[model samples]
Target: MAPQSNRVVELRIPSELGYEKIAREAVATVAHRLNFTKEKVEDIKTAISEACTNAIRYGSGSDARMKVVVILTADEDKLDILIKDPGASGAPPIDIDIPDIDGMVEGKRRLGGMGLYIIRELVDEAGFVEAADDDEGNQFRMVIYRVEDTKTESSPEASASGADNGGSP
Candidate 1:
């Protein structure tokens, strides 16, 4: 078989409330082309949507004049996504915390802070990349593996069966 090459797709969208949907659709098309399963594709789409929404709302302050950049790198094994925003709202959060849904519903905690947490859970890896001295924006990255082997030693079933029991027998 021929060697697989990496394919990249870049998109620039205005930093507006509704622009995230554009990114959502674009990622869905790319993920489908990479032959990802329907569930995985849906996950990717949702993850990208949340990330882009954060970039638009917080990173660029939802300023339509600002632009949010999305870069997707597709390889045989995985897909890498990077989102760049103008950093108008200062630095990105250093850590992600689970949403306080109960508090929000009870009018104690503020609503709509679950984007990062959702993104983290949906993607294999999700984080804000540190920028170099010359860089001026926040760069957030997410990676999703294309294939997952159900019978691997790390699988839940294998672990439950003690397949990695360190030769205790």
Candidate 2:
């Protein structure tokens, strides 16, 4: 952890699968300093990895020349993760309902397209920033509140969740 004063940390890496290790390590370190539970830390690590992988695979299409920027902001009660894909055209809006976990685990449903679902499950809230048709970047954002134990809780905000509050125009 740099200093408690430095609430936001940024990392930019080539959009490749190999560099994902760095992302996981950085995220875990920050999350640990925030005193998140071990299980929560592991979940955040996994979710971040999945988000990065998806950004590389689907966003940049594994383009080595493109870049992925991960911004982690920690506050008194929550952590916000924003992943920007420089080459992504933004995901299309989807109207499908959340996948049924039982069916997914039972092999009755398709296996792909589970990253976003897993992210939504692991974090307090999840969202996407659609790039404009003329824009060059898209974003995936996640919000996780400090969950030291079952009794602790925090409120979710549109800004942190990247909801309809002008994350992208």
Top model by lDDT, which number? 1
What lDDT score belongs to each candidate, Candidate 1 first? Answer: 0.79, 0.72
Taking all chains together, the TM-score of candidate 1 against the true structure is: 0.84
What tens-digit string does per-residue lDDT give for candidate 2 at 1-169? 4345548989998998977778899999999888888999998898799888877877788997988989999887778898888645555334323556788789997656666656655777666766567856767777888853322234334223423322211
lDDT for 159 in candidate 1 is 30
Per-residue lDDT of 61-153 in model 1, one digit per residue for the tens?
Answer: 999999999999998888899999998988777645557789999999888788776676577667787777897999888888776553342
Every candidate's CA RMSD: 8.3, 5.4
Q: Highest TM-score: which candidate?
A: 1
What RMSD does model 2 have? 5.4
